[model samples]
Target chain A: MGNRTPLYEEHLRANAKMVDFGGWDMPINYGSQIEEHNQVRQDAGMFDVSHMTIVDLSGDKVKPFLQYLLANNVDRLKDKGKALYTCMLNEQGGVIDDLIVYYLGETFYRMVVNAATREKDLAWIEKHAAAYDVTVNVRDDMAMIAVQGPNARDKAHKVLGVAIADQLVDIKPFFMREMGDVIVARTGYTGEDGYEIMLPANQAPGTWRQLVEAGVKPTGLGARDTLRLEAGMNLYGHDMDENTTPLESGLSWTVAWEPEDRDFIGRAALARQKSEGVKRKLVGLVLEDRGVLRDHQKVIVDGEEAGEITSGSFSPTLGKSIAFARVPASVGTHCQVDVRGKLLNARVVKLSFVRNGKPCIDV
Target chain B: MSNIPQELRFTKSHEWVKREEDGTLVIGITDHAQQLLGDLVFVEVPEAGSSFKDSDDCAVIESVKAASDVYCPVAGEVIESNEALADAPETINNDPYGDGWIFKLKPEDEGAYDGLMDADAYAEVVAEDEH
Candidate 1:
């Protein structure tokens, strides 16, 4: 048996196929995963993302604590409700986790981390925050719902009150605002305009039902993965882990290197790695052959073991197999993937495959 | 509550078989199997003229979430394959018992076809898995 989320009953009622994901009994998909994926890409779909941990840090020194903890500097977030996507690195420069931090006030910052890394993330934050006088509060009472796609915001707004909907309409991208008791952020993983709403756990069922009645299709984790992958977003465990640094995980852009004096954790290691030069790189692969590309498949660059695929799948949006692979820096626009016993030809492209329901690369 | 057609024979691996009038055996993954695999994105069928022993893995089915093998119930030579699935893999999800038929084989031993499970026996096998 696995831990059940607040929306477990709601999922069961919707006839969802539940699976054990990171110790939680969550819906993989309600029905056809491809249809659900298309729903989020073309229409509106809602995901019960409550399994993700929500940690709030509050104290006068919270700003300094975050600046020292995350690789991305939070000093750029001057406005309230502004958010920053960053990776937390270990002392060895390997990624501990990737998270989103929202600045709510001068002394308060809220962060949402991956579900599988909850315990470790909380422990890391608490251990480092002791010297900064920041109190770590896990928001277990809240349940998160990500409503995404092209018409996601408008349909979701119909479920919200007029005043809240009006404010939500003006909330810029990567920004969030609290209305009454709910925090609505104009952000999503599907590379579409939408909102990630955090509300009381007890009210989650009612809100989900309201959204369903308003034409928001209930989706699950299966679509969430393909959506994020199509958008060229990196998943924490697959793309990078405690053994991989952000520099090799295609997350170097997220690292704030400016104001070099600001000492953050793993800063020295990252600087050293940068000075020495990174040997491998993360690139996208589009299979030119018939078979599907999958994780751990060997990437053969010029008949040699260049690297391996981190995440691969048949992209419903592109109608082809695509993957993220760590390969030698010399790898160019073409390569081959070893699927089963066949060395299938593939084309290397930019990290992103699809964005906003359109193919980012030429078909 | 997966549909187990009364007229067809089944394999323990969730494949369903129907003996055609011309002595060829048509096969496909059962409805219950398709339900378990979700929507299939790709189907790799064995080409005609390939020989296989009983219980040999004859085809591959891939979904967005997983990949599974379809085993041959009895020793046979491949006679034909459902080539339409190359363009529309979702046919298996839509009608696993009908148009979703995967391949046809000319059985080497006719008696081996009778050894396959009947609908009621296959139902018991499926029931055991639920627990």
Candidate 2:
């Protein structure tokens, strides 16, 4: 059995059918997944993402420590409270995990890592922190709720009360601030404008209830998935795994290689990859038909095995099916997906399929 | 929706088998099964005129989240299928006990229905699994 979250009882009250996800009991959905998916796109939706681990790294060498640890350069966070999305890599240049790191101050930085990869992420951080004299504090005391969609901010402001609402509205994207025990970050995974709030675990159920009272619909991992995939974001275990590197996983842009000399954990290996060139690349697939695309399904290009779909779904926003696949770098603009033994044609386009309730691709 | 009507019996796998007025049987997944699987997006029903063993998989239902197989409740020959559902699959979620039924068959043996659960027994099974 999976460990229950602080909001387990609340989910039960809401009549959610719980499922075991990465050792955490989380709601699959309340009743209808399509209704919940549509709700987030059409209005405000809130999700309990408290199972995701939040870790605080502090001490004098924090900046330099992160500079060497993350695939993306930390120097980009010039302002306090700024956040950067990055990949933590292993010695082999494979992605250990992709996380969002918030630059809290000169001495402190906060990281939100995937729940499934929490153990490896901590061990990786601790192993490197030894040389840099940094202290890593895992913040199990915090519970997170992500309120998303077009009206997410306004609804959240109302629920948080006027005193902190105004400040929250003014908070920049990827930045967060603490108002007593409530930590509000203007960030989201759904490709929508919203806030991912981290508060005391004990206060989360109340906050979630308050947001629902203020008109934010409760969503689960089911919607969280379609939302993120539509945004062209890669899921940790599916799109990319320990065997894949950022270069091949469509995350090359996140790696900063300036000065070409300052070495990070995966720098040498990635540089070697750059020199050798790459064979595979991640691209988006929009089905030309009604069928849903599924993960690991073969992608056929010119009757050859070009690649496989890493993530696929029937997109509620587009009213069609779409996918993200890792195909041969030489694979061109089109391919076919083997769905239930039939090869259905698909169009290959730039990665993101949707953003902010709109299709990213040109019709 | 109604208590598994006494005229019918259910399988442990959650299929309902109803003995017809002619002594043949009609089969479908139960309301409990459809509720467990949320919105039905696609369904591959066993083609008409197919023969199957008691435990054979007769149909496949695919939802947005996962796919499930419907097992035949008793040995039978598939006589007809719910062909209209091919275009509109969500009918199962709407009426699993009626129009949502997958197929009709000629039962090989009448004794198989006795192995299935009654209304009260099926409810107990579901309630037992919930907690």
Candidate 3:
């Protein structure tokens, strides 16, 4: 009863368990979620990310417009195809949405934002672009597929054929290359080496089938959540929202404050918060006992509620439970999580638990 | 269609009960229930000798997707709890009717097992839910 992506039929053919995700009926998993998670970590896997929104911004003032609009400096993208991950902030220093912008040309840039935040993001971009005369084009005719893992690139290259593969040989991480009508970016949400391919919507099913034939296992949104959580990536609406700033959401590194004169939106508020010091901070938690860490669980420090978990789940790779909690800056390494009326012991760790199919933290 | 053993009795909530020759009852979640919960990672079974009323929330099953409560089908005292599931919770997903049984219970009323839904009736419940 919801919106269906270009690959919806393919998902049904694969016996995927479909669920409503941000207004689109997408696959939660094909069969076992843990199996799909392990497949992506150990070998190659493909995901139907066609529901994501793609926008193209163009005009002579595009560069300057982005400089004022994004929290991260757009000047850092010096080369063509280079991508920068940044947060678009409101006037009050709250994060509107986080996105990746790729430098295509002097007057043109491509952006991929979260699907749920598409309408608001487009409205905000258009509202600010009027003064700069930048044109915004939403590419609804496109579909995206992400192929990930250690063997992901090789498997994807096999499906893309020799000519397209040859053009991507020199592609670096966070860089994109256009092969005829397709744009392949060496980037992905999963903490693995992969490419997120964007092409015509009608060609998505064929491309997905080709990748599957090449032995890339089809993954779903369930595995994507666990993989991204292990990668220490912040999911929109969960880790942070329009009410929270990037500084408090463990995303301080994404803010570019190098050019003190560059007065981007929310710069003054963030500067004030920086000078005053941020009281609350986001940190990672590893359950020391046998239990699953879930979202909205209260984080108890010394028998008092100090914070709450923003995102939590069982880590298939680690064989343990992990979570992201926003606690007082003074909270120590040890805390307890209120899991269904029981306070279980937990140890605080760095943001990431796994990377490159290996454990980043001590098990 | 999900596997529904003809010898077993079921509750509307998907718990299956099998009356043993000794009057003790073995209970577990149905195949349809495990399929709905996805891969089970953690299970909290009732302790042996624990008493519960009918329809009481007595056990917990946590999957990668969400945590679900296993309700007590009838008023009974637990005779034994399956401890193996603490280490291998996916046993329920693999063999829901046999080795994945959660607990053995001695019902308070001798005729309580007969009051539960039969295999054919439980099939109708599952069919109604699929829509």
Candidate 4:
């Protein structure tokens, strides 16, 4: 048996097909994964993201501590409740984990990291935090739920009550606000308008039930993966890992290079790689042939094995297959993918294939 | 429990076979098999007139999650393939026993279909796999 979230019983009651995700027994789908994926795109859908790790940092030196710890300069977070997406890197410039850090106050910040990387992320933060006397408190008592889609905000606001909804109206994208013990953030992995709510663990099932009653469809991790892939967001372990740097993983924008004087961990290595020129790059591929692209498939450029797919899936929104692949930076408009020994044609396009319930690329 | 027709025969790999009145065989993945592979999106069946040995991988079925191979239950020559599934692969998920049949095959040995497991025995195979 794996670890269970606060809403595990709720998932069981909904007849969810449970799967082990990062040591947690999580829902993969209820009946159909494609239906769940479509639900998030067309209407309100909620996912239990409580398996993610939440940590609270505080103390007078917290701001300075973060500036050196994160690749992206924390200085960009000027306003309270502002969220910044950044990759925490090792000394060698490889990603330890990608996380969202929220600026709550001068001496306080909150971070949500991947569930699988929880132990390592906590240890890495604690190791570097000792010198600055920054306190790292894991908020294991909290549960997270992401409500997404065009109609998600309205439906979620109804369940959260009019008072909190009034305050949420002004919360801009990538921003967050706290209502007593509950934290509502206008953020999500899916490229859609949504709120990721963090609340007391005991209140999770009730809140989820209320959201369901308000017509927010219950989504699962399977849909979440497809949604994120469509948005061109990289999964930490799949797209990049300890051996690959952010520069080659389509995450160069997440690395802050300005303030040349700010020496964050892995900054020197990233700078050296940047000056040396990155050899490989991550790009999106759309299968023109009648087949589904999959991970680890060989990407054939000019009949040579030039790259490999990092993440691939059937795009329910587009009615086709799309993928993210790391290939030579010189790769052009077209390439062939070796699908089970047969070569199939694929078109190389920009990183994102869909955003905001619409196809970003020509279908 | 998945629906297992009493008159049909099955394989451990989850392929179902029905002996046609003309002595040819119609084969497809069992309902239990389709349920395990949720939401079929693409299917690649062998070309008509292709020959295969018993237990050979003859077709491919892809779902949103992953791809799986459909094995030939008996040595046979493919007489016809299901072309409609090229556009509507989910028909297998909707009706695995009827319109979803993957191919029509002429067995090299007339009695090969009778050697496959019956519904009661295939149920035991599924039961064992679940545990």
C-alpha TM-scores of all predictions: 0.99, 0.92, 0.99, 0.99
Backbone clash pairs for candidate 2 read: none
Determine which window of 10 residues in candidate 4 chain A has minimal summed lDDT: A254-263
Position A228, candidate 3: lDDT = 95
Give the true-contact fraction for every prediction, in order: 0.81, 0.62, 0.81, 0.94
Pick by lDDT: 1 or 2, better one: 1
After aligning candidate 3 to the native by TM-score, how far in Å is the CA of A109 from where it should be? 0.6
Which run of 10 residues does model 2 chain A get worst, by summed lDDT?
A: A312-321
Best candidate, lDDT: 4
For model 2, residues A1-363, the per-residue Cα lDDT tens digits are 787778888899998888888889999888888788878888999888999999999999998999999989888988888989999998888999999999888899999999988898999899999999999999998899999999999999999998898777678888988888888999999899999999999999999999999999989898889898989999999888878889999999899998577679988888888899987889999998656788999999999887999998767788677889999999888899998778899999997988988899964
Supply the global lDDT for candidate 2.
0.87
Better-scoring candidate (lDDT), 2 or 3: 3
Summarize candidate 2's per-residue lDDT along B14-78 as a digit string, tens digits. Answer: 88888787878888887778787787777888888899998898888877776788999889899
Query: Once model 4 is optimally superposed onto the true structure by TM-score, how far is the C-alpha of residue A47 displaced, in angstroms?
Result: 0.8
> Cα deviation in Å at residue A255, candidate 2?
1.2
Q: What lDDT tens digits, residue by residue, belong to model 4 across residues A22-103?
A: 9999999988899999999999899999999999999999999999999888899999999999999999999999999999
Query: Which DockQ values do the candidates obtain, in the order shown?
Result: 0.84, 0.57, 0.89, 0.93
Taking chain B only, the TM-score of every model is 0.98, 0.92, 0.99, 0.98
Using DockQ, give the best candidate's number: 4
Using DockQ, rank the candidates from best to worst.
4, 3, 1, 2
- lDDT scores in order: 0.93, 0.87, 0.95, 0.95
Could you tell me the lDDT of residue B67 within candidate 3? Answer: 94
